[model samples]
Target: MWNEILHRSWLRLEQNYHFNDSQNVLNVLKQAYAESQRAYHTLQHISECLFHFEQVQDLLGDARAVELALWFHDAVYNPKASDNEECSATLFQDLLKDDLSTALLAKISQWIIATKQHLPSSDQDLNLLLDIDLAILGATSKRFIEYQQQIQCEYHWVDSEIYQHKHKQVLTHFFLQQPLYQTTFFQDHFELQAKQNLTLALAGNLK
Candidate 1:
């Protein structure tokens, strides 16, 4: 179902440049998400993001482009690597440069790369996309704990103490975000629960 929707988006992205078989492209994406090295950055994450996208998509100026960016934002994932976002953006650029307008491609790439820090953006589309990506932060208690475990599994190679410290720092940083989610929808729906979840994690109670 998700594949079909994403494929349709790809096929109709733009008629300026001829594109190749979109199924093959989607197959590559499935393979990437299914990589053994991943625990959280998987199809499940993408599906969750897509679910969130469907909710507020009507608010976006270029919803399809935002959806495309969401589809490719995590195309490259390495728990130990810092350039995952850049690499993901590059992958999107390489695959669609022939199809999408250069300006649209650039904006999509920027949207994908923006997930790195998940920082606030002046662009409403970007703000919505980022909020969707981080929606797990404000998921229900069971899902939030699962997300923590999934993240831990991804970085399981790291020493326990080091991972613990760094993980705490990561949680704290997010906790300190003046408004964790940039969009009103997410802020209205998830902000309170997200802050509670973050508070618990920072206090070492969520594990």
Candidate 2:
């Protein structure tokens, strides 16, 4: 499935530039996602984001850039690192600099950076990408619980009490956001469920 998604993304890009190292780049990305320490920021997360993007593909101004951003968003994840998004965006530019236009590179960089805050953006594509990156918050109860646990595993080095305290603060910030998802599709389908899940999780019910 990962291969198929990578292939599809490559097909979209191949129209503009011929990359002789496409397979090599795909392998590196696959390895990054499959890293042993990854729990929530794994290939599965990428697949889920891609799946959500398909639901709102028609609403995007640059679907190809959004798709590429999804593939590289978590490409440099590190539980202890705060600059993963910056590094991932840099990697995207380095690898595809010869292939993509300056404007497209800028768009992809903006999309990746926006995932860091998951804030609303004036650009529709960035808003949709942010919504998709956070769709897990509105997942079914079972899946949402699994996601919480996976994230805990990713931060296993931290003490449980410390983790919970920090996690609550993060979730509370999301609660403070008037609308968790900016896109109408995500807002309509996930906004209520996300608030419910956040409430439950923050209350220590789903920990």
Clashes of each: 0, 0
Best-matching candidate per TM-score: 2
Please give the distance, in angstroms, between residue 79's alpha carbon in candidate 2 and its true position after superposition. Answer: 0.8
What's the lDDT for candidate 2? 0.86
lDDT of 2 by residue, 109-178 (tens): 8778778988677888888898899999999988899999999999999998999899999999987788
Where is the poorest 10-residue window by lDDT in model 1? Answer: 8-17
- Quote the lDDT for 179 in model 2: 84
Q: Residue 116 in candidate 1 has what lDDT?
A: 91
Clashes of 2: 0
The global Cα lDDT (0 to 1) of model 1 is: 0.87
